[model samples]
Target: MDGTLIVGVDGSGAALRALDWAADEAVRGGFPLRIVHASGWEWYEGHEPSFGINRDVVRAQA
Candidate 1:
């Protein structure tokens, strides 16, 4: 945890490219690579909660 490389992923093509670059940098720098997937939809007051919506589904989409 001393030297970690954090990469934000959103299940997008651009994110995949960044993840690849971060992985290589992590390896060369001898640091741990941490992948973080996040969503703000759950926190937005304007977001409507439907019957099928859940944290798992949101996380999977991230």
Candidate 2:
């Protein structure tokens, strides 16, 4: 109640499901939900890289 709900996104089905759940929870709780996608691997480039942080370390700091 004192903090916020933060979710991570990896473009996976599970991630999408989590997003849906977060949205629902936000609506019910009357709070805001933050969706974060972290894509920092070498394979993820261009738009993919633009989605999230580069690695877990960076996200943890955030």
lDDT, candidate 2, equals: 0.75
Tell me the tens digit of each residue's lDDT in model 2 across 1-62.
Answer: 74578889877889889989988988888887888886646544543444464667655743
The candidate that achieves the highest TM-score relative to the unseen native structure: 1
* Clashing pairs in model 1, backbone N/Cα/C closer than 3 A: none
Q: Per-residue lDDT of 1-62 in model 1, one digit per residue for the tens? A: 46789999876889889999999999988999999985565465665666546878665665
Q: Please report, in order, the local distance difference test score of every candidate based on alpha carbons.
A: 0.80, 0.75
**Candidate 2: segments with Cα more than 4 A from true spot:** 44-62
> In candidate 1, which residue ranges exceed 4 Å CA deviation?
40-62
Report the error of model 1 at residue 15, Å. Answer: 0.8
lDDT of 1 at 4: 86
TM-score of 2: 0.61
